[model samples]
Target: MNIRITGTGSYIPEVITKNADFDNHEFLNPDGTGFPQDNKTIIEKFKAITGIEERRYLEENLNTSDMAILAAERALENSGIDPETLDYIIVAHNYGDIKHQSFQSDTVPSIATRVKHKLRIKNPKSVGYDILFGCPGWIEGLIQAQAFIKAGMAKKCLVIGAEALSRIVDKHDRDSMIFSDGAGAVVLEETEEDGGILSHESGTFAFNEAHYIHFAKSNKTEAPDDLRYIKMNGRKIYEFALIHVPSAMKTCLENSGKSITDLKKIFIHQANEKMDEAIVKRFYKLHKMEMPKNIMPMSIKELGNSSVATIPTLYDLVLHNKIDEQKLEKGDVVMFASVGAGMNVNAMVYQH
Candidate 1:
């Protein structure tokens, strides 16, 4: 049951936000193209505040699915898989192209139709679906695709994770700076080859839900109300990751029968660079050994958190930047992890 990620593609909107733009706005220019003009410079204060040099977004009113469709096309093309040959499609998105998309809606899969209709995927055998999770989404989609393929139900699957954090954001809130709109797509097809997902692990600590998450307040047909939008406790998030991610990361490594020493590099959720260091520090403390020099923590800070799209975009960015030359390699373990709104925590080990 080899599931190879043969292709990777991502879409970022054209708009670029600059520090000078922020200077002119009274608020943080919730659209977020510029830095604060009155009190800050892009150099000293802005980067320190957001850890972002520049962020990207779709033009105003462009929905998430628009970005999704583009990413899907690129990934499909990159994989050399015709849309007409796709057996299944699943969308992992916090929101979609529609104004207020339904979670329970088969929109996940039906999105394939929109992709087909918009992108002209002519696959008659394709059925589309969706999954709900925040940053942990693409990993969940991969798990689902592996299940279907292993069951002999499908030959190939297009697993997409798209995010438009910009939609639910509160413009007045600085916390909103943590989000951006982007989408990523991967073509996962069954393979007889060895290098793909080797082991998977996940845990949901529901007790943390009280501090951070989203809940539906109205009928599924109704658009999300203000309260239904995503809510965050930045303090709680920092605290949760610093404490729990260490244990969870150990589990992912141990279950895969690999030690942190065996990995060439570690790629965890790029939530915050500082937070990733804390996890590495814990590993150092536990073993009385130096953390792997191969570990490089990153965040999509300028683009905000692209939610489910984070990992794939990160993966693509890594490859584009020649992560291999930087020392991530085959047979060496690559770690992927995310903690999201269900109070969920998950990590997996991959043999590159």
Candidate 2:
């Protein structure tokens, strides 16, 4: 069964902070790589370390729905599908419009209802569900849509990967520098059009220690705030990507009976610009193929990592930033690789 992405969209917050503003920060260092000297210092150190020239953080009152709504609206618009005719929506977000349970009671229905009400659809019925996976969530959600559509449960589905990570990031920690709030959505519809999602196979390693990041926090004073936020083994993660990601990517391609060299555009989680260069370079060297001149990396000098939003954001960036006619083509293979805390790794192949 082929599940294709027909339309894509994303949302970035409004507030922007610059690295130069961190000049007098307490943590600002003469060398620039050092830890924040103080709360003020972190602003500078964050820019220097993450290579983020500037970043957006949502206002305190904002939530995932605020960003996701914009992203979803754009996706619907780009799909050229009347919202009235849409049949399903799957949100792959860690945060929600209201509390988690509010989806059944209010939030999710409200999101779906707004489409019908705004578009004035005569028949307004669609299934809405939430798909949650770490950074791999979007690809996983895409696969889930394929399954649902294959089962004849839906006609059109919207998958969103949104996060208000800064809300949970421990302000005092170094990892906070990379956490940001954002959302991206892919609109999928079943069609015999011959140019949508083609193949998707994904796997995850179940080791409890495979990945580690801030789990949720409880009022209980058991674990400290630092433990409740982002935790990392940056070097180990790089090592894992070099080893496991290649294996995973190959597994997906092999399972789908396709070759990596045949892919027109390779999309990996944009963890960082440096990581992007290294990972793709390593893979290219191992494959004995000339480095693909067509690779489109969306990582920027700023725009600190947005986790699951990273890949879809790359798709949006490629569509808007350049004029490369050879970049991505209809029916061409698109690859996705995601590795995050819990060491969970997922790989999938999509057809444009």
Best by lDDT: 1
What are the RMSDs of all candidates, in order? 5.5, 5.4
Q: Write the per-residue lDDT of candidate 1 for residues 235-324, one digit (tens) a residue.
A: 687788777777777777788877767766666666655666777778566767777664754645556567888787777767667444
User: What TM-score would candidate 1 get against the native?
Assistant: 0.82
Please give, for residues 100-131, the per-residue lDDT of candidate 2 as tens digits: 22221235554434433444556546655666
Q: Residue 73 in model 2: shift from native, Å?
A: 0.8
Deviation of model 1 at 290, angstroms: 2.8
- Best TM-score goes to which candidate? 1
Q: What is the lDDT of residue 272 in candidate 2?
A: 58
Flag regions of model 2 displaced more than 4 Å: 22-51, 97-125, 208-211, 216-227, 322-327
